[model samples]
Target: MSGGAMLSLDGVHAVYGRKIRALRGVSLEVRAGEVVALIGNNGAGKTTLMKTIAGLLAPEKGRVTFQGRALSGLPPHEVMRMGLSLVPEGRRIFPRLTVMENLEMGAYSRAHGAELAREYEHVFTLFPVLGRRRAQLGGTLSGGEQQMLAMGRALMAAPKLLMLDEPSMGLAPVVVDKIFEIIARINQEGVTVLLVEQNARRALKAAARAYVLETGEIVSAGDSASLLRDPAVQKAYLGL
Candidate 1:
């Protein structure tokens, strides 16, 4: 799992406005078939890094490479077409759309036919609640259901690398546990995951390796178990 690099960011720098920097000389890599967690506080540039990788935002300096191809100025759609799918922080499903419709929208980049149908079935298999609620409006579902929908939507892309931003946000503890379980299951199925989570313990537990970001910088990085046991990480992120 760690032998090949699926994605890499070398000295990446990203900014919100001309003057406000969001990431500064940040660098990391996601190896093939590994779950890599990026954990940080509220304003720690976690979402900004995901957007940069997904091509919603471009780096001011450095490069983003996926599967050996550079993704520096590509549009989001182009990035998606190249096998990177991002489940954004908020469950931004179409409020007016039905569950099935929202899922269909996720397959817009894919060809229509048997392959698409199989992907739909795959999503349904991963999330049976979605299969049961196929006709429900996206906005009507519970927070956990909506989060499942978001993940299902991303899986529709058949991504080689799945980028999840705050998948546990605004959910009950049990729901969060279930979500993390599903995420681990997803990784087991061979989709490399780059997960951005503020829940440090859970994130560390889920990922093989972890990086801690603070004020646009990667302050700590190592194997997840070591980071979890580190005195600094425990005090700062785990409330120990």
Candidate 2:
């Protein structure tokens, strides 16, 4: 029960240094085995929302509830340990560490003998490139491969809810396709997903529901299929 409807942000407001407002009463939710995308343009508070859910930045107002528990004041590591993980916009991998080491770092809180072995096998299965380059330093991998490593490392946490921010930014079309395919596969295996993407077309296709954020507020939200076809959403986000 706790793993499903995995996270919720209700009437959340986030500010910076008491002057700039980053999020204005934002609200969203993610359910089990579903991919929910939040779409927005630049400076729309997408990254801020992700950081809030991950507990890196606490909301100035409103509630962040995960699995029926209040999440305010919880730290990022605590949130991760509770099965929420984030694969951030920029691939943040330890360049000096080997691919295997990076994956191990993802599991640092709970990595053990058999558990680690299973985690390694599972992550490798998901991102075979990581397995192939297991010995290579993370910094040496190509951009796409680094993205894979970032995702694989996130998976190493055995997260119940995975939040992906700007997953398609700067990747080639083919690499983007591959990443989306993996995201679909991950969802099929029952990991709830909270996806933040600027590529609205691809994201709307993958998610079951979508929310469009602008100037730190949600302008639209509905079933993904409907939102994809909405005249306003099409005009504003899809360029259709």
Candidate 3:
């Protein structure tokens, strides 16, 4: 495919426990300032794919290139510094740490502490509730708040591409809607996004382009508008 893609994975393969194959020659991409959603049912290797791109998991075969730079062996922290960040499946915040402290952790990789602080202000603007409860421990926040905190933390890293896995997994409809709204706003502000969501209706609506994954491979790919109208997609995801 095109080397100009913001994030690209070519023939990536990964295994778990030296037995189970999680991804098999999977290749995908998310361009700068675009939102690409990866949708699939349970055990479709969606999360595994995101982990590979985020550097949380290494590919046993093939390669990942972010902005044309190879990212085969880089650790997760190193990847974050390269303007890529993942919100992960769960909130994954520190129970003992205050919300502000968690946000600080996102910026630890950046040398400019003061610049990160300014970026923190932008995060607060996006999720004012986080600023309102900055003193509260992350563990004490509600599920929706925790999701917001997770997003805020990723923003603190000042990423060019933000990868979120199952961000709306277990939230209320209202909360899920708000989270998606924030995602759209973030994209409008110029940060590219790669999102994995169980809520296909919400994800496809929010994304510019989308891919349908079955097992470890892509079954269909297209723009969000077309995907929404696809008969197979409607039957499987849209309930139409």
Candidate 4:
């Protein structure tokens, strides 16, 4: 991994409506080529953090910097253009679209040419099942397959940083394992990952460094091994 911050959130605070605070002075960094995990319970603002970083929600306070440029006021499309892509929670794939069409939607920013074709081939290689089901509607696939399609669509964008939120949610244990394996492969292929997952044990195992977020704030932060061994973390998150 490179010794530089690929994405950084400095004292970011966000709210909903008018007074509902979702994040409080949340600050963290994801270095290039590293898989960083953010683990927390439901209602801990994990999704909020993902959306905030993706430019889906502008922070009320603090700064978001990506690739050394400020991202505070940039729109979501602009953020994607800058090499940041988010595969949001719940595997939000278009049910009506064919697998190939969904993947095409992801590369909307790219020119329709050889490069785009190569991207499709790349995603197909990553998930061979997607290639087989290219003509099938996304909704017709199994849950696990839909998840793969969502990830493949994101890969079509060829992002430098890929942020995944709860990619393992609602899947069988075997499917979850496959998802993590793909995540590792993606990291090895050089996309820095910022992951938010509820499966604490799995998330810790997958990430190099991790931050424990609780009640809209960071309660702990360290390398995965250290956090896994932490007594408090074990009792509350790891079920040890």
Candidate 5:
């Protein structure tokens, strides 16, 4: 692993069922305190890669290391305990749970007391609306609010590496902007973010580095500015 890399995936491969291949020799690194974007089309194995890293799925080949610790055979809960949290796609907040309940679920592995209370305050500070609606059922919130709640829930874990998948999907343009703004703010506060997003343009703008995935493999990767300017990337992803 590189000295500064907080997360590293080396030639990783994952499959589904038995025959369906999802990731193909994927390799990437998320450096400490950097927001690295993974942009890809609908079926491009982006989520697969995220799941693999989070220990939701075991890779068939290669290695996944976080903070220099091998994560290959660990379970999801163990991975979470190691300071890696994933806010999965679809803002999967518990509909029946109140906002506060959902956030508490995120901290299940954490100790009870002052530290846990501080995490709640921290999340509320980031999304004051959540604080205001702490008693409301999560299902009652709007799409944007639900997204915020999901992010806040993940933050409750105090993760050093936060992986966000498709955070802006199915939201209005203005809402998307707000989401990205918060993402930048989170990164600035020292979280190493690995963001998988469908809105390639917004992802590139928010990220310092980016990788392009296609059909389960990485097709391009570079500094965000260079990737944004590449003719192929512009034409295929940026709609320019």
Candidate 6:
């Protein structure tokens, strides 16, 4: 609702196959340098909202703005150049490419050289195992490693806002903990994050502010700590 929003969606509505509506007047915002979370059950349009913002799926109505620029019809590549990047639900790495190659692909919008090299070093610092396996094929990395690679690759682009979809999906508990920690550290380094995670408790813990989506609309929103303690949110999402 404020002009200082780093990313804002105003009454966005998206449809699929001319029949199903995935987003119904959804509106939310992530301010500069903040970690925000969107938590919901399956088919709640979490991914669709992320796609709309990333330009993977165009909204049939309403507007998406990043840094005061409207992004309704921009293509995904153009959105990336505007300093917004999305790491989709799965760890969609270039399976055949080596780890280093995958990281290079993240910076496709930029020319190769000193700046890219600096980003590479920063990614390696965040996930040292990735640095160790720089030559390994992406497909061969373990699940946790692949998740790390996904985040690292996105970071390679040096985005101002990074949207992560289910960063903890299908991973062991310990690995999920590590992944959330890395996310926090990434935010500490000045990258604003909008995370969509099914793991509500962990998502709330990692984010400062949060929104709870139900059937394609934001049903509730507040600071993460308060939502964590909310009776309805606890029973429905937190499984308490």
By lDDT, who's the top model here?
6
Residues 64-119 of candidate 2 have per-residue lDDT tens digits of 99888898879999988989999998988899999989988998888488877887
Which runs of model 5 end up more than 4 angstroms from their true locations? none
Q: Order the numbered candidates by lDDT, best leading.
A: 6, 5, 1, 4, 3, 2
Computed on alpha carbons, the lDDT of every model, listed in order, comes to: 0.93, 0.89, 0.90, 0.93, 0.94, 0.95
Model 3 has an lDDT value of 0.90
lDDT of 1: 0.93
User: Which tens-of-lDDT digit does each residue in 85-170 have in candidate 3?
Assistant: 99999879887999999999988877776787689899999999999999999999999999999999999888899999999988
| Tens digits of lDDT, candidate 4, 1-240 | 244888999999998567889999999999999999999999899999999998999999999999899998788999998999999898899999999999999998887889888889888888999999999999999989999999999998899999999999999999999999999999999999999999999999999999999988999999999999999999999888
Model 6 TM-score on a 0 to 1 scale: 0.98
Q: Looking at candidate 5, what is the lDDT of residue 70?
A: 96
Candidates in order: C-alpha RMSD to true structure: 1.5, 1.9, 1.2, 1.6, 1.0, 0.8
Q: How many steric overlaps does candidate 5 have?
A: 0
- Which model is ahead, 2 or 4, in terms of lDDT? 4
Per-residue lDDT for 139-209 in model 1, tens only?
A: 99999999999999999989999999999998999999999999999999999999999999999999999
Steric clash pairs (candidate 3):
none
TM per prediction = 0.97, 0.95, 0.96, 0.97, 0.97, 0.98
* Model 3 worst lDDT window (10 residues): 108-117
lDDT by residue for model 6 over 148-228, one digit each (tens)? 999999999999999999999999999999999999999999999999999999999999999999999999999999999
Total backbone clashes of model 2?
A: 0
